[model samples]
Target: MDKKQFVDEVRSIAEGYFERGEFFCSEAVVKTINDVLDKPFDENVTKLASGFPVGIGKSGCVCGAISGGVMALGMVYGREHGQAMQEKMFPMSADLHDHIKGIYKSTCCRVMTRNFEFASPERKAHCIKITGEVAAYIAEKLYDEKVINK
Candidate 1:
């Protein structure tokens, strides 16, 4: 599949999961990516990302989507020790970071969540949008890196 097609599919999955209350932002993105990739990581460790949502326990330090994207990248390219792996991990993480930054103008959950009415339906809708798009973006990057086939 092409990037556009892959993204569209994953976005649907992520958005649906969020809408159904199956998972929050970070979990939704990670689960969508892993599911699409045929479950590369152990399910037990998948919960490691749960702490990232609400910007690290609702402190809003970093966007949960951004954190989830980075974790997904690590799941593919990480290694115990190797410069080659480091090359992939660091650059791709930064690339994901840059993409989110460019989109929201900031990677902080608080900042990205700004400009919307607090506790409003629209705010929730925007978060759902982010949850999907961020998953799609990570999936696209993995495909582009040839780490996974489309």
Candidate 2:
């Protein structure tokens, strides 16, 4: 597949996971990125994203999708004990944050979904779209960085 196709596929997969109720926004992003990257981390790594859905257990702080994207970035750029942090880590994370904030005007879940009633179909759809966007963004960044080949 070409780069665009691969990114779109990543987005679709994440959206499907959320739409099917198999996972929430954060879980879907992490799970899809892990899968697309050929499972660099264990499948169970998705559990790490579970608390981020609905903005950190529904406190509505950051958007779960963006939070997931940051975690996905960490999966790629994060360091272990005694290792220096990857130079790209902080910049890439900030880039993802800016990208999402540029589109939504805020990264706060409550702010983004304020127009929709919680639990309504509209809200669900919005979240699913954001989840897919986040996944696609990560995929594109990875491809551009040559972290993943087409």
Candidate 3:
């Protein structure tokens, strides 16, 4: 598939996962990344992202989608014990943060959903959309970096 199609597919899968209540925002992003990478980590790797949803376990801090995107990036760019860190890790993660922040003006969950009532369908829809966007952005970045093959 071409780059745009690949990115859109990732976005759709992530959004479907969130919309179906199969996973929250963060989990959906992480799960989609893991799947796209052909399960580089075990399926349970998604648990690492579990607490990130609803803005770090509902503390209403950073956007969980961005947090998940960072974790997804780490799966590709992070280092292991006794291994040198990848130079792209920090820059790519920061780029994901900025990309989402640029769209919403803030990475805070509360701020992004400020106009919606908590637990409302509108808020859920908003989060689902954000989840898809983050997933798509991650796919595009990885594809551009040649981390993901076309």
Task: Give a tens-digit lDDT track for model 2, residues 68-124.
Answer: 999999999999999999999999999998999999999999999999999899999
Q: Which order, best to worst by TM-score?
A: 2, 3, 1
Using Cα atoms with residue i matched to residue i, what is each candidate's TM-score against the true structure? 0.90, 0.98, 0.98
Model 3 lDDT at residue 81: 98
The collision pairs in model 1 are none
Worst 10 residues of 2 by lDDT: 95-104
Local lDDT at 86 for model 1: 68
lDDT of 3 by residue, 65-109 (tens): 989999999999999999998999999999888988999999999
Answer with 1 or 2, whichever has the higher TM-score.
2
Error of 1 at 74 (Å): 0.6
Compose the digit string of candidate 1's lDDT tens values, residues 38-145.
887777556988899879988988988778878877777777664466677888888888887888788898888888885787877888888887888888877777
Q: What is the lDDT of candidate 1?
A: 0.82
